[model samples]
Target chain A: MEKIPVLKIGNLLLISIQTDIYDSQGLQLQDDIANLLQRHSFRGVILDISSLSIVDSFMGKIINNIASISLVMGAETVVSGMQPAVAITLVELGLEMPNVKTTLSLEKAIQFFNEKFNRETDQDGSSQE
Target chain B: MEVLKSKTLKISEEKDLLNIRGLIREYAGEIGLPEIYKVKLLTATSEIARNVLKYAVSGRMTIRILSDIYKGIEVICEDNGKGIADVDSAMKKGFSTSGSLGLGLPGAKSLVHVFHIDSKLSVGTRVRLIVWRK
Candidate 1:
């Protein structure tokens, strides 16, 4: 069996999940990713789901949970590279993850994060009550 | 009345993980399930199939389509393997006895209209799921 891979880039954590996203192994990967975010204090997480062929309601729930928990830990979560079919399946299953950002590509996701980070820093530098 | 039934799938070495999804789609379609319902059922069935192959060593699934005012598909997946010792806790979202993401049962339940599990420690585990067309 192939293992799901996780990588850290700057303050962003990228998790390359192997196996169908509906399976137990894939869900475990979600939990593991959440733990990593809490432990490392990453600023953001990018879940690269291009490899997944399927995403069921259960997997969606786990991903949603991860995104929510990450926010509590002060980390924003972004899901990128979702196959169109997987997105359709998730929508049909009524699986919606609130406050989770999505991007078409990793580069776009990184750019979005950079912009958000810069804006935050600028605001912090200028104290306006 | 016997509303719907399919030929028994032979348990064999030729069967791979992908085959399970195909079987599920065929049966689900036969039961008049919408395309969306078919996709969800396929995913849930695939998860259970993976469990069968990983833990049971070998097994087969029987799907029956129920007919009434409300049409639905019922899948009974049975395997002789190490039965789940703590089904209640296992049903929790993040609990996995195999250290897996533990989403198999929870995912399956979320996809179907009804979900039930029956198991004996040494005997086996039988998972039943019904997905109604909406």
Candidate 2:
């Protein structure tokens, strides 16, 4: 089975979906992300789907599941880079993935994670002091 | 209506789903559908195609380009499997027998300009989807 690569960078896993993934591939990605989060101490996941031109109900479901699983595994998940058309279709399809956080671009997602975790760490450090 | 071009493709495997989307995109471009409408058509086609794979195990799709009163694309998906029992309930949101989100049929219908479905208990199911150029 072909696997979508999950790259680790500074306490986060970055997955850039450069192609329209198959349904099984999406399921596999969810499993892979869960495994990575469980084994590694990753603080967040950034899923870049800007390259995906269409997001149907199944793909939307798979993404929602991934975000939920990542949350359970103690990692925040942000899906970024949705094309304008894709966003419109998602709404028309009524797949409001309320649980998943989204950003306009991968850069913003990374910044979001940095700020989030940094703030948490700051709080922890100050509490300790 | 005049038929410009027509093609048929088998939809059995997961890869076929991607193929169908690509084919729809190509045909929609050929017919001069707007990019956003193209995405809507592709997404709707995907939902129905995935249902065919999940329930019937396999199916076939026919893509036809039409001209005349409505310059549009029509897709007919047919599958020979245990058919849907209650289509009305099936169309309702958040209804699924296979533990899915049950959004495929309704979501697909919402995206396209025209939609139709037919099914029988011991026979099979067929769904017709169409999107027009605007």
Candidate 3:
């Protein structure tokens, strides 16, 4: 019954997962993301997982699902602020969150998003002129 | 068995799997266990716990911290499910009946200092994992 809040910043959607999410909660999050895509004009999503201390394959798959769903909807997804422990465990398990872009921190992810957004906007602005 | 604290959790549904990882992290943090070892224990517990739920509808996990020469965590997950027919094949990566990433058993074993598994046909499966402070 836990609800994760998704914040809207400009053309970007931000989701910060703060706790260990259950199966139902993860699925609910995916639903929420899908709904948001329908309601807004989002160009990118940054999932902040700085507070999550555990990253099992099951959890990794959920994050990957979110990223893929977003990608299919024409939006870029980046997971930011992964702990060293989580990163090492993911590698050692012979598993990775497939198809999702990962960044070291939220700041870097936003910067990356901005650069991509700017290039596309600048090209669009000039192409019409 | 110089046990400092011991606890058991029931794993019956997918929702319950989260508890397994949370409990391991809590216990590891309480002991001030190193970050690497804590992640190891948490990851191992996650793999085994998921296997229990995937293979069996219900299972139990017993976790204990021992005060031996060095502090260590002992996790034993037991389930009365269909049981693994081929232990060796099951242990091999990419060999799964449920089509998991197929690294549960092998990955869990690699993360712990000690690993043991016993499965009987038409009976159940029991897996034990131990991680000591480094």
Candidate 4:
């Protein structure tokens, strides 16, 4: 019954999945992210799966679903720090979660999001207030 | 098959799938299977285990170590649900009714050396996989 913690920083949400994810857990996370998006305004979500050693097609689908859901709600999702074996398995499994973007490291992910949001905020007619 | 060790696990819930993965990793590693093979076995088991949870809502998975003319590990997953109507089509990528990517059975079969699946209408499904030590 472990809950994956979601943290809010500025205009983004962060979730670090370090353990094996269950079906309920994955569903709960999708719901949590969606709920959080409603109560607050965010532009992006970053999922850190560096500590994860295994991932299957179901888990891959969940990630795909989350990214799509976030996209519909006006936020993009960025996944960082995937293990090599997992990447190989995901490719071999043929999961094409195109909406979910990937950055090799946390630092790069931060920079990527920072530049994206900063550009949004910089525009005079932007949605952000 | 000369058995070195074996254990049976239940895949009746969401959490059980994760535990089964951990158990498979431990047992497979204990048998000294290589890292890549370990990952393949783990991924293959995850696929079938998730299928059991999705299609049947519950099932049993047995892991056994074999040592005779061939040294390796074997995994069997059984479930009593609406049996796959057409395994040939089901095994094809992108063929799924449950909103999945339909990569479970096919992805699993490619990871191991020996694979077999048997099921009947309204009966159940039994998938067997064996990966020899190399």
Predicted model with the maximum DockQ: 2
What residue pairs are clashing in model 4? none
* Model 1 docking category: incorrect
Task: Give the top-scoring candidate (lDDT).
Answer: 2
**By summed lDDT, which 10 consecutive residues of candidate 1 chain B come out lowest?**
B6-15
Q: In model 4, which runs have C-alpha deviations exceeding 4 angstroms?
A: A119-129, B68-70
Residue-wise lDDT of candidate 4 within B83-124, one digit each (tens)? 889999888888888877889999888778888999887999
**Which ranges of candidate 2 are over 4 A from the true structure?**
none
List runs of model 1 lying over 4 Å from the truth: A1-53, A56-78, A81-101, A104-129, B10-15, B30-32
* Candidate number with the higher lDDT (1 or 3): 3
lDDT of 4 at B131: 84
Report model 1's TM-score to 2 decimal places: 0.58
lDDT of 3 by residue, B41-100 (tens): 888888898888777889999999888888888999999999999999988877888856
| Candidate 4 residue-wise lDDT, A44-100, digit = tens | 999989888877887888898889989999999999999887887777777777998
The lDDT of each candidate is 0.74, 0.90, 0.86, 0.86
Chain A TM per prediction = 0.85, 0.95, 0.93, 0.92
List DockQ, one per candidate, in order: 0.16, 0.89, 0.56, 0.55
Candidate 4 interface RMSD to the true structure: 1.4
Sort every candidate by lDDT, greatest first.
2, 3, 4, 1
**C-alpha TM-scores of all predictions:** 0.58, 0.97, 0.91, 0.91
User: How much is A81 displaced in model 1, in angstroms?
Assistant: 5.3
Q: Where is the poorest 10-residue window by lDDT in model 2 chain B?
A: B17-26
